[model samples]
Target: MLPGHADFALPAPAAPVRLNGRRPIPEVPQMNGHSEAPSANEVPPANEAPQPTRSEKPAEPIDVWDQRVAGALAFLRRRLAGNYEVDDFGFDPELTDALFHPMLRVLYRDWFRTEVFGVEHVPVDGGALIVGNHSGTLALDALMLSTAIRDQTRAERHLRLLGADLVFRMPFVSELARKSGATVACNPDAERLMSQGELVGVFPEGFKGIGKPFADRYKLQRFGRGGFVSAALRTGTPIVPVAIVGAEEIYPILADIKPLARLLGVPYFPITPTFPWLGPLGLVPLPSKWLMRFCPPIPTAHLTEHADDPMVVYNLADQVRETIQATLLELLEKRPDPFGL
Candidate 1:
């Protein structure tokens, strides 16, 4: 004890308070010096606004159209700045995705009402040769086929097409073709693309298939010398046979003007129902329901040694031709009316 508080004594402790035979809860002091606590079920005063629960909070709005516009503008800026990549074959994937594919998607989806089947047969990775029947007079089937592959497959693989020499000879068309992943149709290019694990697309039927009259619509023309088969074999790439229906009906060729075709240095001068009669307006393709089916891939890995064997190449080419023909017939049966929904 200190000298000043020597006489001070500790106060006696208060007895414990109980209510309802249990320890009493201490009251909470309020700002007004009141020791009463609010009840658990008490409601706020009428003057006070109710607080919003977590679920009742407003969410920030998102404008999808605005976002798309902004994205397109940015893509344009990048393109103008030359800030994009192009492969050795002159394939500009960015341009293909942003420009070419979007434009073709409109034709592929709304105009043609294209449907794809057996897309799973296309490998996610590695080289493959896709041989398809060519028609539609303008090679529109190739564009549609490329669009279908991108849309249906899980990986959205780009198909490197083999274009004719005439296609590469044109001024504006050549640039577009190269940018869209097309190279000159030759064994060296085909083998190179496949060996590098690119999905290469080829129309072995060539001009014979696309230039045929509507009378011979679905009848496939001769697949050239099986050069595509030899290329696939050399690269040890799988060959995927594809059948395309409805392209023939799009620009039904009534006749071929041989003299005019010769004069213009073109393979054929097609005389469609509306072509010369309708003038520029006739260039528009008719709305035809398109069906594309990819057949099971024929493995060439085991036949690499027989790449130069003419007999082996012939048999494989025949098999692919037969598969495509059978699939085309099946698709035709399914779509009885070319323009049917």
Candidate 2:
């Protein structure tokens, strides 16, 4: 202090110490407009609170394989413990939900962009018959309908499909179909399923509906012998007529190859625009907009032995067909285009 000058003689200020290992802030001196080097002794007020800086964190990625593995393990555990549920017809509920349904949902919800209407019309409890238009060269309509019932309804009903003889004729496919809740199409099976208070799904149009040329799309084919109607009546189950649109366009059958079909020993060899020409790629379905509407339940409790009468069954079947046909026409009018709607 004495070395500088007599005017500079004064006690020096105490040095500031760091807090929480942080260096003390410095105040710069003014030179020109900007301040010069700051003093190291400039400390903040002790009474003030320190503010924390805001930081954003990136989201962690999801491991799809992990989820799939975990789900598989869980499914395995359920099966080993005899916790899995399957009907008398070998309809493995656990297997269908845990495995097959996920793959089919990709087609139902994502590819087709399916929209379900009048899901409320399907009974949540007791036995009921679901009759819908069947089409699409691959019978994808049935799968889509099954998905709708499984996903939309509160009860999450499993649709017991009545498959044709050809469906069970395939080796591995027959086993797969049975596990997916499908049984042979017959009066005895339908009656038995309904008696157990199960929801039965029937495609009355049979091969005609699915194998028919795309030009006949949305046209109601003849309901076979009203046998499904008789089944519903026998079990005193209500009939739920469902109208399906957009299945016809998935694979447009331009023509039928009679010679090839006869050789194949199949119902009909469909000549769709892309099939056989595109090879395996032709099997891919067009992402057509799908619309499924469920009409109100037509109660059969009022009708007596009338269900046994051929004429009564015919009239009832016609009524159901007409109703579905009218509804389909209305729905078509509402839809502007097949792909977009």
Top candidate, metric lDDT: 1
Steric clashes per prediction:
0, 2
- Candidate 1, residue 215: Cα displacement in angstroms equals 0.3
Off by over 4 Å in 1: 1-66
Regions more than 4 Å wrong, model 2: 1-68, 77-83
Cα lDDT for residue 92, candidate 1: 99
| Least well predicted 10-residue stretch by lDDT in candidate 2 | 19-28
Evaluated with TM-score, which candidate comes out highest?
Answer: 1
Residue 232 in candidate 1, Cα distance off native in Å: 0.2
* lDDT, residue 218, model 2: 89
What lDDT does the true structure give each of the candidates?
0.84, 0.79
In candidate 2, position 191 carries an lDDT of 94
